[model samples]
Target: MENKDHILLFRVGKSELERIQQKKAEVGIRSMAAYLRKMALEGICIQLDLGDELTEIRALLGRCSSNLNQYARVANTSGNIYAEDIKDLQQLMTEIWDNQRALLKRLSDI
Candidate 1:
């Protein structure tokens, strides 16, 4: 109906044009351009969320790696786990050690 006010018909195939109209109705959009804009905005939002998620994951991993190292140092120096964090830190160190040992041995051989 809005197209009646416009000079351009856009000349798309029947199926494609129908799909565009269907999506426009589903999104409660008033025009084809608005539907297209909504689709583009959704795509951009997904990519932004993915990037933020990856950044958070990397930050957590860095914190885990740092905490493991701190635990190893404190255990080696203090000889006792007086604090809960110290105990948890040691467990993290052990987990890191277990994971790295396989690679460490291979690297040492080379």
Candidate 2:
């Protein structure tokens, strides 16, 4: 590690401090000093807003899991599975892949 011996002190208003803290949390950085240091040196931070994409992916996964459970129950009781049930699962999987690809594309653009 490089020597970080110098101390830089600064002051901001209440709202400014809150904004700084919010940005730090958004980027998943725990240390305020480290976050401020990086921002000061780099002068730019790229924060991706992926909440919607991730939420959609999570919903798709939940549906896929529920469908699998239902299929398993039906197969266990009747020893038969329908083609339509499999098709629905495949469609859910395809949607998940599409969302993942879009997310990846956005990340790559960043």
Candidate 3:
């Protein structure tokens, strides 16, 4: 017969601990030990660079809002709107939607 007797332990700082928890949550893993084991064995980690995409989306939304507000002001003051402005707004909205869709697809691929 064989007996199993072993223990493993380690210490991590508050920030390091928080980062571990965050990674677990991001990977949809519930067990901390299992997550660490898998990472240690397989050397697998996911690092997403979503900041640029988010920034671009935010800027696009800001532009859309500003353009809409300008259109509203013009319509209110003069009771008239131009076709070119409407077309430009539509183009901006399309770009925003397209970028959002791309981001979603990238996330799904992960």
Best-matching candidate per lDDT: 2
lDDT of 1 at 37: 58
- Sorted on lDDT, best first, the list reads 2, 3, 1
Question: 24-92, model 1: which lDDT tens digit per residue?
Answer: 898788977767756765744321224544554456567677876776787799875458876665665
What is the TM-score (0 to 1) of candidate 2? 0.64
At residue 42, give the lDDT of candidate 2: 85
C-alpha lDDT (0 to 100) for residue 65 of candidate 3: 98
Q: What is the lDDT of residue 4 in candidate 2?
A: 83
TM-score of each: 0.33, 0.64, 0.65
What lDDT score is found at residue 20 in candidate 2? 94
Check candidate 3 and list the clashing pairs: none
Q: Mind sharing the TM-score for model 3?
A: 0.65
Ranking by TM-score: 3, 2, 1
Higher-TM-score candidate of 2 and 3: 3
Q: 18-105, model 2: which lDDT tens digit per residue?
A: 9999999999999999899889998667998999999999999999999999999999999999999999999999999999999999
Q: What is the lDDT of residue 47 in candidate 1?
A: 19
